[model samples]
Target chain A: MTFANAGTLGALPGRRDELVAHLTRPSTALAEVGCLLYEVGVSEEHPDTVFVVELWTSAEAHRASLELPEVQESIAAARPLLSGEFGGFRFDVVGSPLRGGA
Target chain B: MTFANAGTLGALPGRRDELVAHLTRPSTALAEVGCLLYEVGVSEEHPDTVFVVELWTSAEAHRASLELPEVQESIAAARPLLSGEFGGFRFDVVGSPLRGGA
Candidate 1:
């Protein structure tokens, strides 16, 4: 019963590359921390939007990572390129039927 | 450039109430720790699956909240009632165009 915090992001036109690059930038310090995963890429149905996925040990860990200078800097760098609204919800993984092959 | 960590979850049948109740249960300590928001409901299109949305001060805050005994116990309680898979993505809020009323 792991809790997962998740959300989707909308990117500005022609700025997908910039967004991805900013997210995937070198992060030696972030890696040293307990950040489980941080991936950013373009959406298949909506190319103008980039999908970001991250897995953290806990909500606290996720919040702490945000306070880091590196994370803040990366976000600032990626800001200008966004166009549309970006928001998402967070939920705990109560169960995963896919584990049984659904 | 606020980074929003978000995701969606699927709940078990006839258990939406249970899921929501589990998430919204009274907590004296959790509320004191700066866990921003935790909400659970059903999907409009997919009623069989419950929808969960949370807004935390930061990813770390969301993760740390999970470490609390209350969160853990709630998760364990809700586990058996779930049916399908639950997962989501996290993204940085580069910009929100809706601010202009879209």
Candidate 2:
């Protein structure tokens, strides 16, 4: 089963854009087989609130990605800029038009 | 600008699948032009957690959908099954393989 994870990040005041840039770094690590999509987004209602949504091939694959050095380093780099609140939730992709038919 | 929305819903004990069914009703309202993808997913770690990831032509279109009778009714119907923790965030889709060239 493919895995879709979404999370809420509270960026330190005025550092939201910088945090986005940090996540936007070209992830050479994404070349790993399971990473389908990993994109960052800013909330329309709250600028300091950001979303990290990922589409991976499976649960195990996603778990593996977390162990990769790139994922570990990214977390370290993002810690200080974070307002200290980071929450993420995962979802199983049950339907999608991107597959040509929902 | 296209809008992508993702949300987390906590299901009342043992009511997760029920809530999913309510959300899965063939949404005729989805035929609306701006409504692209409206998918429901369950988390691998927590069965009680659900995700609603939506794609709309614009934020305004999504706002409009909320006013539709169908959308309003769904909200009402699903309320009882929800654990009362309804939170969603919107994201700007910067890249996607779905568009053929990320």
Model 1 ranges with Cα > 4 A deviation = A1-3, A94-102, B1-14, B17-102
Among incorrect, acceptable, medium and high, the docking class of model 1 is: incorrect
**Per-model TM-score versus the true fold:** 0.50, 0.76
Off by over 4 Å in 2: A96-102, B28-31, B44-47, B91-102
lDDT of 2 by residue, B8-56 (tens): 8899989988887777677666656578767778875777877877777
Model 2: which residue pairs collide? none
Q: Residue by residue across A9-78, what tens digits does model 1's lDDT show?
A: 6777777767766666657655455555554544445667776545455566767778889879767877
Model 1's TM-score against the true structure: 0.50
Interface RMSD of each: 14.1, 4.8
Best by DockQ: 2
Per-prediction DockQ: 0.05, 0.30
Task: Report backbone clashes per prediction.
Answer: 22, 0
